[model samples]
Target: MLRIKKLDIFVLKSFLLLFAGTFFICLFIFMMQFLWRYVDELVGKGLEINVLAQFFFYSGLTLIPLSLPLAILLAALMTFGNFGERYELLSMKAAGIPLLRIIRPVVLFCVFLGGMSFFFQNIIGPRAQKQLWTLLVSMKQKSPEVDIPEGVFYSDIDGYNIYVKHKDRKTGLLKDILIYNFSDGFENAHIIWAAEGKLELTADKQHLFLHLYNGEQFENLKSQSVISRNVPYRRETFKEKHTLIQFSSEFNMVDGSFLDRRSDIKNMHEISVAIDSLTTHADSVGRSMYSDIMSTTYRGAVLTPADSVKIKTENIAVINTDSIYNSMTSQEKLKVLTTTENRVKSLSTDWDMKSFLTKDTDNSIRSHRSDWHKKITLSLACIIFFFIGAPLGAIIRKGGLGMPVVISVLIFVIYYIIDSGATRVAKSGEMNIVLGTWMSTIVLAPLGAFFTYKSNKDSVVFNLDVYAAFFRKLLGIRQSRHMFKKEVIIHTPEYAKDIEILDEISKDCQTYLETHRLKGMPNYIQIFTNNKHDDAIAEISKKMEALIEELSNTKDAVLLNLMNNYPFLSVKAHKSLFDNRWLNLLFGIIVPAGLLLYLNIWRYRLRLEKDLRVIIKTNQSIIEQIEKQQLYLQK
Candidate 1:
């Protein structure tokens, strides 16, 4: 049995609210995207209210799987971001609650969401997609609303291009109308000119009724007779005339059962069944084609007992076709060559046709296989995105929609790009479908793990200062120090001890310079394998810092100003290449990278020598200033 704590309840409540809101927001966004893609189809079809509602409703249902992952990602980010911003996360951690424990409730909820996503994708999504796509096709096939504008050719009507010069808005009359009708064929076109006309839909709405006044109609007689030149036509003038054109304005739906054959409009079980059937059909077709080709190739061949013995003894007779062709008459040779060529071409064409039979089956198998993997991959994406978003939010410590929204969108875009690119490649048969389908998950799982680890350890993963310092050290950039004279002396420097320490530091620097040749390149082996330590530099730095701390309290402005001239030494700058011994050894084993690291180490070694030189010169100068002050005081 599981017990629910207040903390768990608090976390669940916060996450659930954000999840619900973000889910709908994501759903709405994806639905709008769907609408934008098919807006042209839905706009002029004059679909009923119920039909339009069903269209949007089915589209939303199909988009639910896509929306779920992004929604989870945004919600997780916002939930944890709000917690971190308000220091609630910090307080929980302060109470000995780990980051993972704090996020336990949300993680469980994400798992539940994943299951829900799987259910929808495997069950409801297929049916909705079928309905949605069927409706889209119906909408696209449906005719546009009849709205003929003035001074424009209205070609939306099938087989007719009607140009209206003017129209009476109140009377619903078209003036100076010119029409081209090629319903039968272009050669049998009918051109008409009418002084006035009016168009209206019939009662059944399956035909357009055109009433014309003072119209002259010209009907081409070219199609009536097969005359090559001087084609004749018939003409008629009428005071009033009516023509019935086949134009269906009523809304009609197409048979949606055709969409059942698509891979996307199938459940996991259906896809599996499809894949198996296709594979079996492809195999049988391949075996049959192979047999046919083999039989055709060896159609007239026979192996005698002597030829079999020759085969066993590896002494088969070789025929010289050139000599045989030379022995034959020209007509006989041409007859044989023609027969062989025809046989070869016939076999090639037959093989091509047979190969096409299995090609479609193989493609169907691949589609079903890819779709099967898609259901599982989409389900796993929800849980994976939670790990990424929650830890990333805690690291950024930014709450509300502003920062989290931007970050979530960027991450989701990256995921979408990878998923879409890989899916296309996989579907094209250029890549293994399973690997391509899982490529996005494989790429992001490690990132999620890294973020979670860093968040749990409370690492400053995005601290710019830390990164800047590392790069500065890597590039051997010099840093300056600032020192000031104290207003009140808390512990004034013992000038005698300070002088002695300065002398000691200068001697140690001189000794180190003499012992180590810092101008030369670092040893490759030592940089990688050996852990190089500079005790002299470390000790000198320690003494220099201690002496500076004492002298900073000095009332003498000159001595205080001179303290700023001390070089800030990096005590471990000349240490081993990395803190990890194994990693250092690995780098050493990689020759090209080891050479680069070797040169970088040499640069650090050179920088260390310069720092020591500056430290020694500055130390001597400070010592002379202190001695001069003492000498003047003694006088």
Candidate 2:
């Protein structure tokens, strides 16, 4: 039995609203990019409104799969971000509903969205891709609308360059026109100058009609010339001349059947079939190439006794070809060398062609295989992106379009870069097709899982202070303690106890420094192998901190300032790099990396020694100040 709660409906409604809007936004953006790539082909073509509409429609359909993952990512981020921002997520968690339970409905919806993405890619995308390509080709072939500008040569026509000095738009009359007709050959060209001409397109839009009022035509009869430098020309002066120029302005679509050979215009089943067929063809060609090379190039030689001498065991004795070459005449040697060189060259060229053929077939197979995995990977990417975006939104606790949009774009860009690079390498046969096609998924899935786990457990995944502290520990950076005089002293600090603690801390620091040889460099091997804790330094640090805490309540500003000067000590700064002995040994075994790490450890050791010296010095100053005040009170 299934029950739909108000929570599920609420979550679904929020996500669906955002998803619908983001899907269209992503689709429009991708379509704009797609159109920009072929803007040159579409502009000036004078395509009809319905044709342009169909182009956009098919383009959107084809880009639906690409847009789905980004749309889901943005929508999930915004949905969860809004929830967390509005305190709805907090209220739900407080009401005993975990983050996972809240997001379960959205997850299921994302799964459904993934299915829809796969459907669009497999069923609708192929037809849209084919139609879009066909329309683009048709647009490219269609002639530009005829509007001859003044004073510029219009070479958009196939074989004619027409220059108009001035033209009347209302009456469509040109004042001065110069035309170069190279339709016959460049050498046999015709140049025409017209005083006034009117250009019109035929009803079928296939040819240009040029009616000149007064013009002279010059024809170079180079083809009729018999000798060089004796070219003849004919000049004709006419009052009225009508010239028909061949220009096809009508839009004719290319046959899309040829596009079927493309891997993108195929379904999974078709791609699988293509892969099998290409693999089989490639294998057969390789086998045939091997057989041809063996049978034709390496055909066994049948020899008589004169060609080679036979031994007692009926095996021919080996002969030195250099000795045989030395015995030959010069012309015979040259002839034999020429023949061998030609044969070797012929064999090399034939093998190269065969190798290229085999490589082409293998590339095709890889392409088909990559596309086959692409369909499934894109679908899975939708779900992966949702998981990532939703959990990240919850962790970041950012709502509205600003932060969510930026994060979503960043994540999607990373995914797109990985997928594109991997797909290219896979197509080039440099990597396994499956791994390359699914590389983005593999890289991001664990990240999504980690975010989900962190968000579910209400962990601090993005807290800057936690990471700052970690980096401080890693770099052995010691922060100065900030102590100030309290306005109201809960318990007055006893100067006698503070002086005693300082004395003990100073003594421990001196003893540790003397025994541990703080001034010298640490032994590299001992640094890694030894896991001993510096209990002496730790005890000194513990007492110093406790004394500072007690004296922080004192009304004396000088004591507060002196307490602040005591440096904060890190207990494990000079300890073994790792707690695990095996890891330490392994790091030691790696020479280059271990050397660098050992140097870093030695630097930390030096810092630790310096901090201990500073502590001892600061403790002596504070002790002297406390004893001076006590002696003043007695006086």
lDDT of all the models against the reference?
0.87, 0.87
Tens digits of per-residue lDDT for model 1 on 1-635?
77789999999999999999999999999999989988865687778898889998999899999999999999999999999999999999999999898889889988998998899999999999999888889888888888899888999999999999998989999999999998979988999999999999999889999999998999988645465677889999989989999998777789998887799999999998888888887888888877876665664333456765776698646856689789999999899889888977887887688767777777777788888999999999999999999999898889899999999999999999999999889887899999988899999999999999999999999999899988877787767888876677878779988888888889999999999989987666677776656677888888889888888888877888888888878766565766777899998889898777777777778888988888888888888899888898899
Q: Provide the global lDDT of candidate 1 against the true structure.
A: 0.87
TM agreement with the true structure for every prediction: 0.87, 0.92
Q: What clash count goes with each model?
A: 0, 0
- Which pairs, if any, clash in model 1? none
Point to the candidate with the largest TM-score: 2
Q: State the displacement of the C-alpha of residue 243, model 1, in Å, after optimal TM-score superposition.
A: 0.9
Give the Å shift of residue 247 in candidate 1: 0.8
What local lDDT does model 1 show for residue 308?
58
Give candidate 2's error at residue 71 in angstroms.
Answer: 0.6
Model 1 alpha-carbon miss at residue 313, Å:
15
